[model samples]
Target: MKIERYLTNKMLLLTSIFAPINLAAQERPNIIYILTDQQTATAMSCVGNTDIHTPNIDRLAQSGILFKNAYCAAPLSGPSRAAMFTGHFSHEIGMPSNGIPMPEDLRGLSLGMLMKNAGYDCVYGGKWHVHTPSIPNQTFGFRKLYEHNDSGLAEACSAYLDNNPHFPFFLVASFDNPHNICEFARQQNLPFAEIPMADLADCPGLPLNYERNPYDADVICYEKSLNYSAYPTSHYTADDWRRYRNAYFRLVEHVDMEIGKIVDAIDRNNLWENSVIIFTSDHGDGVGAHHWNQKSALYEEVVNVPLIIVLPDKKHAGAELPQLVNNGVDFFASVCQWGGVDLPDGLCGVSYASLAESGDPGRTHQAYIVTETLFDKGGNTRGWMLRTQRYKYILYDKGRYREQLFDMCRDRGEMRNLAVEHKYQETLNKHRKLLYEWMNYHHVKQIRTEVHLIPGF
Candidate 1:
């Protein structure tokens, strides 16, 4: 079952002639998927964020195709990770909130299970908050190396690679860090290491949209008002917000160091030419955007996570593609394709691997990507975001000004709300119809929404 060097979307051509110590060229490439918790898309230095130093994450971006438009399926740990491994939206899999168990039927068909059942040696090390705190062997199929802890997970993963077999391994090193920012915000002792803050003047300046906008979504205010423990920033001063930003960036750097360990482990085996490396986060932190300190908002900072993929042959190294990818489901698809496994029928994701092979830098695989969020509070508190080529449409189940539209290209900061602008009404309805059609196609009925059927659409 060795894989040949030449690969297509469907399968790897058959081959033979195995080598003992050094793996034969026909063997499938080892897939190293590294994940970090609560990391924003721009948190890495590779994406022009001067506030942080993420050399290890930056190195991956330098050596692979760094996708700028990668978004999470849901902006919470449990639901997002569930979508990622199951190749389905959170609601589709019956998990739209944190700590909810994944459906039993889908558990056996998870990404790890799919790859493991297909003959690849899969190892999962670190945080897996996809309903359960750790991946289950009875269903999820990956060999759990250890429970999630940043202190020794890196060394453990490195040692595993040193002791394991030579070729065709699927390894996951999921780290927990920047997530410690939660503890930092709570004013509790650091779970990892204490992030020392710089002087007030020396700290990174506040983002332009630091203050809540006049037309900010109403539910955002409602959610914050009720969740005091989560949104302590309600009492934060301008200087306090800057310090929070400083700590957030420092936490990002903390995780970056741990990531370097796994990358070094892969490099030690000389697997660069024979392994596929993918790095991303389950969800992104708010990083003090719009007076918000945590995730769950549909802001760009909350949903978009960094994605850097290093293919076995190292093709397209250093290329930053603008493809709009739902890193959750799309990642599930791409991994299956890269590992030479057939995708399960009815997955919403289209593999970026297939799109990348077309050799078109500007190729788009999705008309628009959706990010869903169901609050931890209660039922019917769900919200949805639809991000198209140049615009973002946000809708919530209950909230005044429940809809907001932003022209991402012109107003990347989302300073102005165009949902009320007369001239942009057509554009607004177009996106609303897109969501309406999407909900209908997916059989979503929880939103309690009714979009007028535009004749043309």
Candidate 2:
């Protein structure tokens, strides 16, 4: 047999390099993916929100695992969501803008496509933002789709579960409330509101940078950071911000109610023991954080998203994973891990599903988050950043290059910059190298960082 084993040798070598570490074959679990647009981590009662009641979402968390440090690669809806579907960065998928069609030549495949290929019945209920030329024909491989109907999406999803009793399903429940452009919050009260709130009702105090007007900080820090901008900020005010915040909370409450319906459906159908429920948002909104409204900045409000996963059988139920994780990308990998599906080669994510189940205190890993701002109406490049739990280092390049570093452990609000401080020089340099190395490794473009300003001039 060793006489002519040339191809066999290469095959063995490839297997050695590419074989998955977690080799345990698992039963296919019913997968439910729930994503709310522009909803921040603070909206959930499980994390620390007291303003609006989200008992259903809290129950989902209590019955599963909660991710305390999940961050979105881009804060915009279209790009963030596109990343979620394809498990590829927006830039990599040629979806840099909201209305842009995803290119055909892109080799990226979505979670639905993967699931469908694996023999699961794939379905999409509610928003499908990964628009493409084949869209009218194919909604990324979902055999059934109900796109952009945030109101009745939950009911449609429940109906699907009811209709298909025997077939396993990969269902996506995308809600459109909470994000600004639909004037979702404002239509409930305010109109075309664009100011950051000074305080969140019945919630935590406002961030030091929270603003009620558009200024350098708003443009550079907030707007430039998110992956999508649903609203225009030409006219904004304080009262407007208050009303908008109220409506935003109302939208979240509405979504929470819908979520309960789906959960109840699962319980009613006796599928609770075999289904896996995951709750997360595409990204966070500044709301009133840092004195600006919208996402597109590296502020905690824009990047940090709430993530919870409930696996059947009470496996790793009620565990809190504090380790940092980049959403969208890692989510696909986690799906494969928990669903017992085989993942194709060359995926850029690591599965953290075990952390939810093991409840092992020794589990900890370093994760890096990167955000780049492109040209707006005017031609200008924004900034790039890297964050760890203890230190947040930003490199800003607008017309010229500048740097800002914050010790999150000491000043979690990022009110003070330590890039120029000599004591933190070593830390700054270390993270800079890390960021640079990451950019090179991931094949992402390296851009200069920019200083953030408040919304009002």
lDDT for each candidate structure: 0.80, 0.64
Model 1 clash number: 0
**TM-score per candidate, chains pooled:** 0.91, 0.81
Query: Once superposed on the true structure, which residue ranges of model 2 sit more than 4 Å away at CA?
Result: 1-26, 106-108, 132-139, 180-238, 371-382, 399-402, 446-457
How accurate locally is residue 6 in candidate 1, as Cα lDDT from 0 to 100?
15
lDDT of 2 by residue, 88-170 (tens): 77776677556767666443366777777777777777766665312342446675556575657788888877775545678
Candidate 1, poorest ten consecutive residues by summed lDDT: 12-21
Q: Model 1: what TM-score?
A: 0.91
Question: Between which residue pairs do clashes occur in model 1?
Answer: none
